[model samples]
Target: AQTVTQSQPEMSVQEAETVTLSCTYDTSESDYYLFWYKQPPSRQMILVIRQEAYKQQNATENRFSVNFQKAAKSFSLKISDSQLGDAAMYFCAYRSPGGTASKLTFGTGTRLQVTL
Candidate 1:
């Protein structure tokens, strides 16, 4: 079984600062996909960034980046230049991307508050 974990249930950051949301997943599959999703008040799941298990390089998207430690089964999201708009519930998700319809495994999520 695969599972995602987010130890921090809540986080806060000042404007223009940086914040890192920790995530870890346990999976036996060698090839999979890791993702960070943001859901604001609108409740729309937005893809913040993604990492391919086989890729050695970490994934980054604009102000968002991830530190993927394959051996440790750790994947953390770093948000730079944080803005008020970044305040939302961030979830760490995993997908097998195989033939079977492996539904996404998501963490409990972490609520981020951007303070002025």
Candidate 2:
């Protein structure tokens, strides 16, 4: 079974600072997809970033980026210039390609506390 892991249960960052959240996974499949989803206190899951297993280069989206080490089965999220709005529960998830409905296997979740 494929599984995502977020070691940090809680983290804090000051406004305007940068924070990196660590993630790791275990999978037997050759091809799969990884994603970082942010869930605010309201509980809506939003896609933060994604990385394909076949891609060697890391993926970045504006203030968000990923350090994906396929060999090590690690995928960490880096949030730059953090803001109060960035405070949320971040979840690391995985999905196998060509699977049913692209169901995501998510981690326990990391609660990010952004302070002013």
Largest TM-score belongs to which candidate? 1
Clashing pairs in 1: none
**Model 1 bad stretches (over 4 Å):** none
- In model 2, the worst 10-residue window by lDDT is 94-103
Per-residue alpha-carbon lDDT of candidate 2 for residues 1-116, written as tens digits (9 for 90 to 100): 88788999999999999999999999988799999999998999999999999999999999999999998999999999999999999999999997484889999999999998
Alpha-carbon local distance difference test for all models: 0.95, 0.94
Estimate the overall C-alpha local distance difference test score of candidate 2. Answer: 0.94
- Which lDDT tens digits does candidate 1 get at residues 15-42? 9999999999998889999999999999
Predicted structure with the largest lDDT when compared to the true one:
1
Candidate 1: residue 66 lDDT (0-100): 96
Total clashes for model 2: 0
Q: After superposition, how far is residue 68 of candidate 2 from its true place, in Å?
A: 0.3
